[model samples]
Target chain A: MKEFKVLMVDDEEDFVRTLDERMQMRNVDTSVALSGEEAMKKLEEDPPDVLLVDLKMPGMDGMEVLRRAREAYPGVQVVMLTGHGSEADEAEARRLGVFDYLRKPVPLDQLMRTLKAAYKKKIEQAMVAASFAEEGDFESAREIMTGNTKKK
Target chain B: MNESLFMGKVTAAMTHEIKNVLAIIRESAGLAQDLLAMAGDSGFAHKEKFLRVMDKIDKQVERGAEIVTRLNTFAHVPDHEIRREDLSSVLDEMLILSHKLSRLSGVNFTVGKGSTSVVLEADPMKTRMTIYRLLEFLTPLVGKGSEIQLKAMKNSHGLPSLGLIIKTASLENFCIDGILADPEWNSLEMEFGSENAAIEPSPERDSFVIHFV
Candidate 1:
């Protein structure tokens, strides 16, 4: 099986580092970005299958990152994990197409399940897009990849 | 800026910080547990003890998280001047907030079960403050090992009301007339009057009911 890749973004160094270590131990390929700016840079250079981001951050909060990521890299799934997120924030995240919104201090098993589900979604979308491309439906394939497929 | 709003803003910020602190502690302790599980019979003599301590830490983190969440919600009470709020939920939150005071006085605060929902449109901050003050006054009077069960109901005029049912081991010694006659009771009446509410002794005299307009 291909390695499941996840990029975690948070301002707290200790938290992100510990989470990274735990994910790695669970056979996940995990990368950490301490700030939203760093996360954007990492996404551009090496986009992962899923982005696990914290809502509150120093420079460029998670909402902006979610917006930019959805626009530029629609293929990558994004999940929000925050310690102090409000209902409004969750609503905004859902509006921006976030895969899931989870509270901080979540059990490792729950986090793992969410990440795996996100990765599976990414793969499923990619396969459908690939099928469209093979059939010479470039526009449909683009729509599938960008998550803008028109409803019948 | 309104004084209540300013205080609420500061409190909300502090609650956020506290939540972050708890998250870090939870993750750090969790990491230790993860490492221990991965160790797998490395002959660590204190493994069981460490696990037990970690369990305690996890439980505390859960407790702290709940408190911070409630405090955060309470801090936002001043955001609105008058809002429609469920009487039962308001009483529930105030009961949780008064846990320390109850412990200090050796009293237990509970919300009566199977109570019908009573929604009221009033100043959120003032409503909560009135409830807190009432609990504060009654906690000491009821003395140790007493129970104060709050119930939401309709008054004789069909107005929303909250009934404080006091139960103590020495019920014979508890005097509602004495409390009603105390000088502080007059002050409490004024406070309740300011909110357009009235506190009166129940027919049974074992409880007090606050009638809301």
Candidate 2:
């Protein structure tokens, strides 16, 4: 069983504090940042395996944060969190290459499940990339890592 | 801090606080209306309590409205100036706010029956906040089950100004040995005291008064 590190961002201090405490209790390694800039700083210093980002913030909202995170930390899986579960939100997040979108106030089980799905995606991608590199296939491995997936 | 940023925080907090008050008042008033509609038909019990709750809810809505108006007035106070203004409206607004705090006071509140709106010009918001702090200061003195009274009347206005009399059995001298009694109030007093406003205690009467200049 592999442990995954997750970066979480939100502007509301109380909300961030409570969620951090709960996620830590569930054996998830979490690092918190108040804004997207702070999240990027944390990622650049020590990129987490997964990121859980909140939708609303004072400045530099979630979409812009996601764009920056993906550009800087290509390997990290991004999961966008919103306060709504509307179809429009899901479609937009999907278009942005988000691994998963969880609506708030989400049930505890649903959040854990979404994190698990994202973690599984990362693991599967890592395994394939590793196999490609083992066969002296550098180009194929880089493609996999960069989400290109050099298919036959 | 930037004025807009500061305003945003104040507006957000005030809006949320007033909204909860509105919701509670609506629920209680609606309950009273529903009870009245049913009393004519189902011979329901607790009809009196429902009516009482309806009256209480109206009082609450009035208080909530005053809070919003005070916030608006606070928003409009021109940069430091003293002139003639109606004090009655200010006192009425403060009383409404105190009722919101003291509906559970189970205690009595009084107003000196007068036909005049004691006029004074000062920072209305800070004045309200000071009065608010006084209410906050008094509430815990009498604990939850005590009564409080507030009165406003014209003073000589020659040397002193309009008198806002607050009577509370629970308004203790509860001193803060080193610091000001209330930062919210004491700070405003310190800043604005240069204008000659004074808070005097009536030695014989169980009351304290703020004569706003």
Candidate 3:
């Protein structure tokens, strides 16, 4: 099994750093980005298997980050972790294809399980896309990686 | 800008900040616990005590987080001028928000076990304000060690209504006639009337019912 990679994006320096250490203690490869802009730059440099993002931030809030990530790196699963998101925000996030929505102050065990599930989903999608590519189905492989199936 | 909307906006923003602060506290405490667990039992003294204190911090964080979330929801009440809301839920939020008043007056507010859901279509802000005002009026009148049980029910006209069942420590000290005569009572009645609602003592004289029309 490859090392599970996650990029946690939030403006709260103390919170994200502490969480990053906890994830590392659990043997997961984790990195922290203080802002959405930093997160985007990191995604370009090295995309993680899963993107753990906060919905409310100072600049380029979580939804915009989720949108741009899905557009630029469709293979990476994005999970939304927010403290003050409203129902409307959750609906919008779901519409934009969030892997999971979790509230803040979440139990560590629960968060770990969610992250594992998200990472598993990302791997499964990649494996299926690779299988299609092996059969010379480049279009289907692209569709699988992008999570977009043909209309007909 | 409307006063209520302005207040709501400010409150919503502050609650978000409070939530972030709580999240940081929670994560920091969790990391401390994680480090302690990884260090094993050999190196650290009072490991059990430290773990116990961390557990307390975790519980307090949970409690604070719940209160902040409720307050954030309350802050958004002014977002809609009029909407359909369950009376029971509205009363529940009011009880939580009025904890300070409850402590000051030594009156506990709770929903009656037999309470039913009664959805009302009206101004959400006005509805909450009406309940808060009633609580303010009744808290001092009922005195200490009293309980105000809110129940949702349909009125004689089949309209949704709230019944405030006042259980005072001393029934002899509770005089409905005297309370109705107070100048504040008259003002409350006028306020209720303006909102297309009416408040009057129940037939038993021990409770007040607000009928919404």
Candidate 4:
């Protein structure tokens, strides 16, 4: 659990940075980005297995990130971090294939728990892909490629 | 896209959750009040814990209401892209967003003596969003219950440049690198360009200033 790379994005620089510090204390590798754009740069430079992104921001806010994550990296599990938890927002995040939605001010324990769970999902996804490879199901493996969780 | 939307959704969702927390506080506070009156009539033995719970509920409910209001203002009037909207009005709305935040963040704000409102032709929605973004950054630096004064008035040269000065002891310690990394920050900086607005730390005061031209 410790040393897992995580990207935490929030317009609230203090909040995100503070959370980053806490994650570090817990032995998790964390990076902080104040805005969505910054997060994208970091994401491109090095894609973390899990991204914890704030829901509100100016110009390019969180939803935009969700929409882009699918096309960009496809493998990282994104957890929507928000101060305001709305039904529409949850539905929207789920629709975008977000791993989960967590509201802030986040308790240290709750966030860590979420990170662990999100990491589990990522592992499951990896295992599923590996199985497809062994079975010689190239089409199925292709379907399971990273962010393509929308099994329609 | 996901980043921007994620931030917005989280704020929106937190608003609702905060509302629920407020609802409980309100109900508990109201119940305690009713009990206090009833107890008074019966002369019931004092339960110190009851009083403490009542006080705690009162405080949390107040805080919760403020957070709800901030969310409301942010949600209700985003992107008012018309003629230059009144910075005072826009700021006042944003204040509600900060209301629950001020007490703890230790953010102090004050309008300048020369403060006055002037008209500028800009997109209302974008301007509001820019300030909103700035506050999001500022709130964390100040201790909780701290005051953030918002003064909107015109600047010299007849251009309506709204002034935002964030104050607090920790303001100096606040992280700035991340703010610059934000896309919205870039958007505002790009929108205003180098020629117009000024965003910098004041040498004389513990403040971060933003001038909207």
The number of the candidate with the highest DockQ is: 3
Give the clashing pairs for model 2. B107-B147
lDDT of 2 at B105: 51
What does candidate 1's lDDT look like per residue over B162-198, in tens digits?
Answer: 8889998799889999999988988988987666588
Residue B50, candidate 3: alpha-carbon lDDT: 95
Q: Model 4: DockQ against the native? A: 0.03
Q: Write the per-residue lDDT of candidate 3 for residues A2-69, one digit (tens) a residue.
A: 36999999998988999999889898999999999999999999999999999988888999999999
- Please give each candidate's TM-score: 0.94, 0.41, 0.92, 0.44
**In terms of DockQ, which candidate is stronger, 1 or 3?**
3
Error of 2 at B24 (Å): 21
Candidate 3: residue A103 lDDT (0-100): 91
DockQ of 1: 0.61
Instruction: List the candidate numbers ranked by TM-score, top first.
Output: 1, 3, 4, 2
Residue B203 error, candidate 4, Å? 74
Give the residue spans of candidate 1 off by over 4 A. Answer: A1-3, A136-149, B156-158
Please identify which of the two predictions, 2 or 3, would achieve the higher lDDT against the true structure. 3
Error of 2 at A71 (Å): 2.6
Docking class of 3: medium
Interface DockQ of each model = 0.61, 0.01, 0.71, 0.03
List iRMS for all predictions.
1.3, 12.9, 1.0, 11.4
Better of 2 and 4 by DockQ: 4
